[model samples]
Target: MAEHAEAEHEEEAEPRPKRAPIDWRRGREQAFSILASIVRWVGLIFAALLVLHVIFVIGSANSANGIVSFVRGWADGLSLGFKDLFTPSDAKLRVLVNYGIAAIFWLIVSGILARIIRRIGGVVSS
Candidate 1:
């Protein structure tokens, strides 16, 4: 019993492992990653709005409809002045081409911006 008690005392005397310190750089990187993700999501949303507007126009959706008008309004604003970039004989084709270009532009620009932000964050953390 005494030996067992002495063994228990020895076990209790051992030091516990120390935890690693919190890294603020890791937090900064995580913040940058979240920002990049948000940027990508915004780009996707803009592209989706443009595509939805194209669908509405092509399908002859009623412009008077609130949802259709809302989408059209947002798409027009997000078009980045590409609405009249292309002139086609058919109105539907014109909208398709111009809006498609705008959507692609947004996607590409956002991707580039996100990459830049990530690189900046990496450099700052380092």
Candidate 2:
């Protein structure tokens, strides 16, 4: 009985094998975090440009001013594909078409990219 008890004690004292470390998952998580931050910043920039464009259009910001011209140029360049899709018959309509569409487009694309990134991260971690 003492020998059996000693064997049992020895077994209990021995440590179990360690779990497989998740080194790859940690690396993937960090990379995904950095990517998400960059995407968010880009989205914010696009939204800002669209908002500034709307303000310029609605308030009739003077194109002669350097700041106004710069904002308009940036907005135009960023929203190149979505521009003039709808014929703006008036000033208010123009603002809606030129700025609203770009803002919505950026928001939707950003959201989709974020979701995709999250899904990929989850899959990699799992």
Q: TM-score: which candidate is best?
A: 1
Instruction: Work out the TM-score per prediction.
Output: 0.83, 0.74
Residue 19 of model 2, lDDT score: 100
Candidate 1 lDDT score at position 18: 92
Native-to-model Cα distance after best TM-score fit, residue 32 in candidate 2, in Å: 0.6
Report model 2's TM-score to 2 decimal places. 0.74
* Candidate 1 lDDT, 22-95, residue by residue in tens: 99899999989889889988999999999999999999999999999999999999998899999999999999
Question: 20-121 in candidate 2: lDDT tens per residue?
Answer: 877888888878877876787798789888888888888887889999998888888878677787776896677768677898888778878877887788
* Local error of candidate 2 at residue 55 (angstroms): 0.5
Worst 10 residues of 1 by lDDT: 114-123
Our model 2 lands, by Cα RMSD against the true structure, at 7.9
Cα distance off (Å), candidate 1, residue 66: 1.0
